[model samples]
Target: MAKEVSCPNCGKPVEWSEQSQWRPFCSERCRLIDLGEWLNESHRIADPTDAPSEDPPPSDDLSTPH
Candidate 1:
């Protein structure tokens, strides 16, 4: 069985899995808003592991040089 969660953007309820096309965010627009939040660092999840993250983590190289 799939789980249900509230929409991170609008607080609306959403099923984790559904065939209605809109998923995770309830619609493509919501999905894009979530992505924008992620890009803007409005959302962040702390690592649950006790051990420290690996040294010299790989860079995503998404930044542009000034």
Candidate 2:
């Protein structure tokens, strides 16, 4: 039996097999919808670190002495 999965975009049943062109998505439209979401910045991966990164301190080597 072919394994089934839900489409990430529309929650439709999708078969997980060689015949399934889009394993996670039901159709081309759903795939494009997901792509649009990514392009629009609707989906984002969470940062690994909790704290924000701090900028590096200004370098004094570039400064010319008076």
Best by lDDT: 2
As a whole number from 0 to 100, the lDDT of residue 23 in candidate 2 is 70
* lDDT of candidate 1 over 1-66, digit per residue (tens): 777877777778788875636666777888888888787563345434545667774466556444
Expressed as tens digits, the lDDT of each residue in 1-23 for candidate 2 is: 98999999999999999888977
User: Measured by C-alpha RMSD in angstroms, how accurate is candidate 2?
Assistant: 6.5
Assess candidate 2 and give its lDDT.
0.82
Query: Candidate 1, which ten residues in sequence have the lowest lDDT sum?
Result: 42-51
Q: Which is the leading candidate under TM-score? A: 2
Task: Write out the backbone clash pairs for model 1.
Answer: none
Per-prediction backbone clash count: 0, 0
TM-score of each: 0.44, 0.59
